[model samples]
Target chain A: MAEVRLVDVEKRYGGFLALPKQSLTIEEGEFLVLLGPSGCGKTTTMRMIAGLEEITSGDILIGGERVNDKPPKDRDIAMVFQNYGLYPHMTVQQNIAYPLKLRGVDRKAREARVRETAEKVELGALLHRRPSELSGGQRQRVALARAIVRTPKIFLMDEPLSNLDAKLRVSMRAELKHLHHELGVTTVYVTHDQMEAMTLASRVAVMREGRIVQLDTPKKIYSEPADLFVAGFIGSPSMNLVEGHITGGRFEAPGVSIPVAAAERGDVVLGIRPEDLELTTAEAPPIRGKLYALELTGEATLVTLREGATSICARGPAEFEAEIDAACALAPRPGARIHLFDKTTGQRIAA
Target chain B: MRDRSLQYVLLVPAFVIVLATTFYPLAYSLTTAFRDWDLTRSRRPEGWVGFDNFAHAFTESHFLNSLWVTTIFVVTSVALTLVIAMSLALLLRRKGRMHTFTRVVLILPFAMSPALIGVSYRFMFNPEFGVLSNGLAAIFPWLEGTAWLADPELAMAILVLTDVWHWAPYMTFMCLGGLASIPRETEEAARIDGASNIRIFFGIILPQMKGVLLVTAILKTIFALKMFDQVVTLTGGGPGTSTETLAYFIFNVGFEWYDMGYASALAWILTAIMMTISIWYVRMLLSERKMATA
Candidate 1:
């Protein structure tokens, strides 16, 4: 419904800067997720957009209108908090109808909209129940219903589904994707879970201390990470990085060596995801070591190899079996890509 | 001894203390309320008067006057204190070093004894050479040298003011606790949901604060009914019993006039009032808890 733009936005707490000067544009009807670890300023950016936190510098525009001076109510945005933020005193019906009521909606229209929204979230039967009487997932649905009831110009979700159980989180993620598609609202979501960001965001803005490290589609981000941090942060069984050196067009660690396109280097970190490597019967020349640990993950087997001090893990077939200390060999699956990063700067090196 | 009996034994000291301090006086007073035991007329209790003393209270002008005064003081002081406390809590709940210092300073007024507060206000409200009286006169200009403690209405106002000043800070801390229990997200979500600040407070914050406010109002009501310390130290039931609360009336009836039977009856009446308020408070707490976990 509206484009949310942050032009050179910055946030500081006294002398400590929470978010450095930065700019970002969330296209209208796009789902942008700011993903990072705990102290990363992603939430700070979301709060600034919500008008909950004051921007230390620069402008924030929504729908081409500068909202830096406007109070949150004037910004015409709705948020679903991490805790759902349901009004505990009100029943689900009232909670969903609250936004309309604030705009002076009549009783009949309010009730009709409330019922329709409740049914959308599959919460019609629980409309008369208070938040205290609902389970965690049901409470999350109520929060979702509340935000979508009035169809504001923007939706700000601060890790809305992080509090649910593992199984419920997946289902809720799907529901959120569907909701975004249905509403077509410009949404800014903040979260630390990379998986959620990868699935739910049209573009994931991976943030570090105070700035976005990479702003790209999830597929592009996973395939071509901007740097060492992004390379190691995105994947499930994160990209394996073994430190040694790139000498004579080869990446060499303690017990591993790989052919690379990089020139001779003294020290570098070689990155490879577990899924990109294949386990073999100890006849390869790339990764040769003692089998450290083998884990069966239902669909695949994770085999870790250790020699002296370094360890590397590879995803093998589910039927793959090995003795704990027996010799192991792993090689890049024919067309897999390898990543090389400089040791000192933590920036990816050309390969 | 077994653990079961030891638990009972451990409670013995507390039970004895309660029996001696609370129940004993209550029992003695109930017995005295039914008898003509004027200390000036007899060394011990006189013949049983049945309902005479209790009935006399319904017709006694002074008793009725004290009841009316007490009602006025309780209603005004409790309402004012609750409003002031909740407002202070809201303002002081902001995140800042200055707000923290202000919250810490709010406890000082509540820490002072109510009797001490009364004495301080008495001195401060003096028409002559009093800082508050002269300062107010200076600000208004139309009024100068108005006798604050000598006028009935003004005296009652000062009494209520002293009580409110003494108690608002404590109630503010309670309100702070209640406010703290509400997640900040609720208010922020409301704001993002397009509700104005005033709307958020009245519709969201206040409704959630019902239990705390109710308990504060009832507790303050009981305290106001038993407001005797300030009456003694500040106004001395001054300006023709304008500030004479029920507790002070009972004290006067018993010690001042030596009307022991009537005083005992009056004390029972005050206790009954406090008990009724306490029962209501307990009921509210139960329902609030039920709503919380429903």
Candidate 2:
């Protein structure tokens, strides 16, 4: 396994800066995921680490050696492309055995290792079939098998599970986590799926535009978002952000009032998670609004309330029932963390 | 019933066109291949010749020589054109102003008529005042004053060169179409798998191009076997029947010698060769489709 370090790296396409200068160090044997929406430069960063894309400036060091000028073949890294990239004309056996053959491994050893890798990926029965004959999930397994077959110093996966169906993606995600645990190889995964990042990564780097906005463990990022973007982007239903101001030690807006720790401010945004709010019938609850919508999601119901210009969503019990446009009140559950942010700058206010 | 009759009426024009254009000549030739019909001796077919006209082909010295010449021309031209076309495709597939301009320019040779290409090459290879002849002599002094179309080997080589020049660009466009269908991710994956650029080409790209190359070779083979225009315009069966390809020989037998029966038999033989290759090509394509869908 190797540590991948990007030191003051920047990428520019002509006059447009694709990735601003940034430094990141992915620890050895760590599963670091670059998570963001499309056009966020997450894939660009992974490609640069794989030696597939040229870094416009600064240096990339793998295992403590500068790899700025090294070709991909000389970098001792194996990658699983988003499209699987399996050879369409080659049988599964040949596809998995290619890296071994290229490294000049003897024929007998190559066959043995290929079989072992195939069995690990549960592909032993389909070794003779070409990629065109396999389903998409099978093709993904073949791509994964090929990367792990050679045991390269680092593995780069560029959203390898994105093409599979939702059910298969979850199972494959588990398999990937198990494989990383078994192999202990440094892996850099890129995806726009927040759930995949939360489940698979040792640390998630949330990127926006061209910069790393937040890089932290999944739990820490979920509990304490760095700013308004992270607070909205990390959660499933997302944190409700109410634009209001702190006055008389209480955050207030039309049809809403909430006590806060922050001092009186003109423009403050309140951030609260859906799971942190509970249905309440208190005469003067912290949050009061009219029920707008309700969605049942098996285990829980997503309840949305709108008060004037402010809209908030909260997770209620699965059996919770209410009429639309009815008056509603929601109060924070005990020990629920309350977040505050500066409205103008979208920066987190010190609490 | 009215719609059925209308369907039949709609197909009548196509059937009549096929019968008049394709079947009539084919049936006429098949019957004439077994008969004795010399135009100078009789205006109509004289008698049944059985296999006599077909047998005459194996025994005639000129016919055998023409067969040998055709074999050489077809083999050399197809191989040379395929290699050059594939190389050009590889070079021109990438995007750039220079590559696009070269690709546009490459179509000029293929766009020219085969007869016109032969005429141009004949003029360029003229012994005394030809541009190519003098250019070669300037580069290599020993080649000065050489009679390019007079010598048997040089004449055949020039014939193959002109054919390759006419067809290679068209075949290069075919190869480019084939190259475009291949995904770029496979190559990038190969690169990360520790395969060098050369290894990736041989191991990944070339194998995927097998179907396209086979189609190009078979199509070129069919074209080469029927090569007649160049033979007439460039070499004209040459200094002494040295470059007398089979199609040219068949022309000589029917028009010059007025031996219709013999020429018909020879034409049938050429048709049989082309038919056999075409059937094999179709079968290969069908099997490839089956493998893909499997």
Chain B TM-scores across candidates: 0.94, 0.95
Best by TM-score: 1
- Candidate 1 residues B1-294, lDDT tens each? 599999999999999999999999889899999999989889888999999998999998988999999999998999999999999999978777797678778889888988898888988888888899989999998769799999999999999999898999999999999999898999998988788889899989998898888888888888888898999999999889888889998999999999999899988888888898889788988898789788
Identify the candidate with maximal DockQ.
1
Candidate 2 lDDT tens digits, A1-351: 999999999999889999999999999999999999999999999999988899999999999999999999889999999899998878999999999999999999999999999999999999999999999999999999999999999999999999999999999999999999999999999999999999999999999998899999999989888889888889899999999899998989877788888888888889999999999999899999999999999999999999988899999999999899999999989988999999888888889
Per-candidate TM-scores read: 0.96, 0.95
- Which digits, one per residue and each the tens of the lDDT, describe model 2 over residues B171-231? 9999999899888899999988888878888889888887888889889999999999999
Which lDDT tens digits does candidate 1 get at residues A1-351? 899999998898999989999899999999999999988999889999989999999999999999999999889898989999999999999999999998899999999999999999999899999999999999999999998898889999999988999999999999999999988999999999999999999999999999899999999989888889999899989999888887887888777888899788887888899999997655556988899999999999999988888889999999988789998899999989798888899888866
In terms of TM-score, how similar is model 1 to the real structure?
Answer: 0.96
Clashing pairs in 1: none
lDDT of 2 at B247: 95
lDDT of 2 at B98: 95
Residue B80, model 1, lDDT: 96
